[model samples]
Target chain A: MDIEALRQQYLQQLQTEEAAAPPPVTPEAVAQYVASDGRDDVKICQMIASLPLDRETFETSVRALLDIAADKSVGAVARLAALRQLGSAEFRAARFGPFHAEYIDLLRTLATDEDVEVRTAALERLTLTADPHALKLLSDGLQKVGDALVPAAKAVQLLARDDHGSALPIFRTLATEAKGQVREEALRALATDVKSAPLFERLAANKDEKTALRHIAAVNLKNISPPRFAKVARKLVLDENEDDKLRAAAVSAITHTPAVAEKVVTRRFATAVKKLRATTRSGALKSSIGRFSKVFGEG
Target chain B: MVNVSVKFPSYDSQGRAFVTWRPVEVKLTLAGAPAGASNVPVTVSAKSSAGGGALAFATTLTHLGTPSINLNLPANGAPVSVWVGGLYPKASASYGDVVLEVRAAAGNQLLGSQALMVRVRKNADDLTAAERDRFLSALATLNGSGTGRYTSFRDMHVGGPPDLEAHGGPGFLPWHRAYLLDFERELQAIDASVSLPYWRFDKAAPNLFSRAFIGLPDSLNRVQFSAGHPLLGWVAFGAAGIQRGRGVGPTTVPALFSEAQTLNTGGSLHASYSTFRNMQGNPHGSAHMSHGSGWITSPPTAPRDPVFFLLHCNVDRLWAKWQWAAKLHDPADPRSFTPAAGFPPGHRLNDALWPWCGPLAAPRPTTAPGGTLAASPMTAAPGLSPKCRDMIDYLGTVAAAHQAFAYDDVPFQK
Candidate 1:
């Protein structure tokens, strides 16, 4: 007997049955299926997603999903399904009122779980809570050391979206301290917040900062205020002692705004090119100058 | 029966005397001697060459400022004992045969003699199959004694202390170095041939979780000590119990630390308390927190896990490498003179490491107001204060620490 073939046939048959019957689409029915003995997480998740749940039933459905998500005895796939359902916009909008704290607590615990998928799911779900505890949870997760870091970075993005000022400290720390994609995400998150302009300006101007961090700061600074950033960018481009990568960041940032580009290019083009020739003697800086001239309509 | 033999680790791999172990003691056992042997005066002498040549270095063994003492024999002819101490190799001598002679008190008659060979080599790594087996055997002996005996001692010392003192401050690296040495001494007592093997995480070796070392996770996605493995039945000293937790996903090693970041400056010993200490803590603390869950995840109870020692051994190795390659020196600050709050008087560079007091010891724990332990000295180890010296003496001892061993790979930045 070929057990693999038999299993595939059985799965196809179940899919056919699922298509014909299409599981009930009521909130009570979703909750019932979630709590039922049958361990078909995919079918249950599909039913919950399709349901047009009212606020009262949506709350009830969230309670049932929380139970599955928090249960370590349940398979990871099943728990992840419950978490995704809870993270959905319709379910998140339903007020838990008295159960809000309990719901947040469940998500916080799952955020630190040993399983990576569960931790990712919990982080995604917490982004919707908008509670102060959710912010604290995201901040604490950012400080964690290992695999959860990438997911934590994602959570920071969500938190920054909801309340930029509150997530500023974490963004600043990540911008300077973190490496690779995590750092990029943090810089992007900081740039998205208009309030982070001063911090970005300080980071861009600091000579002791890592070149990568300074570059990100310059790029992000342009997003908040191009004309203000142009002054810092122009200084970086003209400073002979500055790192080449940093000068490139300044050039790239300054070229983005037409007004700022026209003024800085017309003012510093020749001196900047001569400095590049005397110090680096590379075509790289010359090309940047030519690019800036074209943007300023003086090429 | 008359037996004369060199110790189990007669010669280290490089064929030199072990560095940290000084004055390698030679044991002499005598049986069926004459009646007056009980009162016989004996003198033990060592010479550099095999046949009674001039002594290359000092051959005298002394205790309490007195020259070689007489051997005492039981009337029943049970073996009389004479310990030959101070057998370290000279600076220029890579390998030499030391001939030890025992002469009679009156006529200078030869009673017994033996020639011993001494050797030194780099520290052990788990990559070698035999080294791994030896390590597991030593760990089994240490672990079998139960977590309460050893792990509890570490937990109490670090967790109870002048709180921030042992960690997040200047004493972090030095204190942990002393701790690993103390634990290594215990392991040597269990098996003289055993040395603490470091885990070179920079190599990104995937076999660290092999059954020969800490086994990989089981089918349930749980990391348990393998069934029938030496550490399988071992119980945890902390609340985490005996269960092991294996790290998953990307390796935490690269994220937690980079050699470039840790050894950035000829790190100052006199700078702010956070200067070198906090820099070391970046990777050190991150590794502890990144192990996911289990005893290794938390600072206070981390010693309960067997993996903690291997992780710390690598950290100690890095410090040794930094001291050597960077030519960085420890601070001679007089203000760094205060001792650990609860432990003893040894926080200064010249001070002897308290608790494990002996000659050639590491420095004492430095003071940090909030980091100091709150326990009374009376409740701690007795006579601990007297055993410690000032920082100067402590540095002198640790300076020679690598004389007994070296790292297989020093990760020096070009």
Candidate 2:
């Protein structure tokens, strides 16, 4: 529901506290409080949920929760809750259509939040409310996460959700520069879905990528759904002297799409099959063919 | 061969009312002045103003196998002129109007300035106001409307949808171009002014609808209209149509993709605001010079304009371009975007000032206070104040010196 409605509902529930004569504070009250539909109520609930108070003697617990949310350390969640609470209302109130007016400071801070979750949430909210500012912030913040490829990758994913393919720069940074899981995740993230299609396109387009990364991207193309994969796969399969593993990977990837399978299963498929046929040890080829056969539901 | 009736405004010399014939459907066709019949031979060319310039067939009849040459016009409206005799040998007596011009790789050149005039039939004004409104809404939706995607300015999605669908979304250029045309046509349907004073972004901004048209710097109390013009609207919608007095502006490379990059990264604003409000650095809300192309030249429209789609496509393309261009090499590489960066830090979904910099109310940590320091902030390079800071920053810090993201900004030239 919209933030105003949620807030009013939460506040109304809180007002009922006095009418009930205020029984011993219990987890129910705390849960109810956090569950309150409003941002303030949610903030209160999150604060209370993390406390160690018993219902009968809950005064101290509620107080502590409020204090902590107020505290700098717990502020991220507090801000998140507040933003979540009020965001809907703010969005509804904005006068600009096809545009949004900005309220300055709040945006600047949210754009550069310290907590990744809070930052992400803030970006999402900003995307709706203060589009121009949000876009500027995103462009500004791409370099904020260095070496931290997971966060960087996450950032890229978020960017991709916005159709900001420019985030590819960050993805590229993570794909090559990040260590271990970060790099792998970046590469995987880059290959998955139509949004990541650009990443795969780059992989196919770039002649300079590390041979292994290119191979992985080609393999990852296998997981994509339908016509999009087919079009991209066809392009990859046609490139001359494509790495053997990559070519096999392209062949393997094509099996996922029926259209691609139908097209590749012909002379293209035979050529790839023949290439595999030429291999002596054929370790990669064997796996690719195995995967291909399984995907095509071949006997 | 099947014969087709030909209609025209006039006939050619020798009292010949020639309606040259060619295949209607099939690609196979061969009939034009034979290969080498033109020693400085004068040529004739014809075209239909209707039918989007579909190729008209040309054929020649003769005693000796009727030497005929096929003239292929890409699409027809008006045929170009050129003299033929200087290039071909005039061996045949019945050269016909399809005279030979100098052969070139570009296309078949017509040999003469011979003119064929035909009063083209006018298309009926078909779009209604409701249709126009729907078109506007649809255009806005296509241009700026999206959930997480922020394609332009006026696309703030704080709590609810950017309202782009409610108003008009981002398809400002095409929607309006189509809209104005339809409006003119609508009026024409009622027998109103059929002559629409086209906005020549080249000569000057078409400030015809003055009252409704506001320009940049709303504080100026000025309208984009020609001050004395009566047809233009008088109401002001803020500084929407201010900057007038136009000249041919520099060609700009569309940066929709780059714009998308910043919007996405910052989580600051939606696409609408990014496009309109910040047409030039988010200063004057949704007011600025509307971009356009010339008459002879193909006016770039959204989707049709490579700038439009390419920016989005390349935003897509770059993701691909990036995989190979550079992978994250090191933490300080400046190309990295990590989760730890704390994107969307506080969730001020409705806050108009998104992609905000600074802290939320008390307790919200503005900067990533973790162990790692945020890398050096990128800035616009010397003398290069890109309207979108994100592009400038990225170009300065990450992109090579030679790599530049092209965008349209108000030309500072007087």
The numbered model that scores best in TM-score is 1
TM-score of chain B of each: 0.56, 0.22
lDDT of 1 by residue, B136-218 (tens): 55665465424323553454344323223344234455666656655665565554445677765444545565654565544
Local accuracy by lDDT, each model: 0.48, 0.30
Fnat for candidate 2 (0 to 1):
0.00
Expressed as tens digits, the lDDT of each residue in A94-211 for candidate 2 is 2222112333345445556666655555555444222565655554555763322125434443343333344556666777678654565456545434556566656754677765
Chain A TM-score for each of the predictions: 0.53, 0.42
lDDT digits (tens) for residues A1-299 of candidate 1: 23234434433543454344333256667656665787586776466444322333545666676777787867787676555444331212113335656767887788778787777556544543345655665666666633333355566554553433676777778776787656755775676556777877988899987765676576566545667677887888888888765665455434434444655665457455545645675344554444344445442
Q: Tens-digit lDDT track for model 2 on B1-414?
A: 111122222233333221111111112211243444332222122332322111222231111111223333222222322211110111111113232122222343432222221111111122222222222222222221011111221122112321221112222221222222222222222221121222212122223122212222221112232111111111111101112212112333221123222222223222232222111111111011122110101111122211122112222222212221223212243333222232232211111121223223433333211111112111112112111122222222233221111111100000
Q: Place model 1 in a CAPRI quality band.
A: incorrect
